[model samples]
Target: MKMKIQFIVLPLITLLFIASSIAYAQNKNSAADNRNAIDRMTKELGLNETQRGKVEGILSAEQKKVEAVFNEERKKLQLIQEETRSNLQAVLTPEQMQKLENKMRQEGSKNNAQKK
Candidate 1:
């Protein structure tokens, strides 16, 4: 029936969207972490005082740029999530919504565990 098809297709689309978003977030976080590591390593490595000062300045500027990009990306992601939630709400019943929420929570927990 049309309702059954809608039920199946909607959840599949939602799950795929969520999975892709999470993967994108993970990639962004990984890039930030790598940048942080590089900055730390650069600081720890011995250099002339002038060179160290220059490196520090460069790192500070890079951090600000990265933070700006991150904030923009986060805003975009939030908008996408809100739009997806609204669309999914139209297609999903309360019970289905709960299931989707639980699935997201479980995925989050798994990601956290993997990070640890």
Candidate 2:
């Protein structure tokens, strides 16, 4: 029985690991696409060699700054979202909350599809 249980669990775990790896690869590809878009924009702006180097450095720094800001904002937004959800649960009817959740899920799906 233990061997049979291990056999069943092993395949399920392997499948989940494969699925997660594929998802991570997709995210990396999406980030590459975004970087390509930035590079294309930089090329179109016609910077000279020295200017290009400086611009690239500046852009890299800005990207890091923006990422930090985004991380901070995301945490704050998550907290607000949790609080709002809690308040809504207390004050809103179940049907209203369900509608809100459906709307949020739809928006999230649309955003994910757009990233792809």
Q: What lDDT would each prediction earn against the true structure?
A: 0.66, 0.58
Model 2 weakest lDDT span, ten residues long: 9-18
lDDT of each residue in 1-116, candidate 2, tens digit only:
53464355434433443444445454445556556756776689765677666766666676666566655655665565567567667755788667656755565555456556
Q: Write out the backbone clash pairs for model 1.
A: none
Model 1 residue 105 distance off true place after TM-score fit, in angstroms: 0.4
Clash number for each model: 0, 0
lDDT of 2: 0.58
Off by over 4 Å in 1: 1-46
**Candidate 1 C-alpha lDDT tens digits along 1-116:** 53675566555645555655655666567656656765676668856667666866776677668667766776776777788778778877888777777776676666557656
Instruction: Indicate the residue-level lDDT of 36 in model 2.
Output: 74
Model 2 lDDT, residue 110, Cα: 58
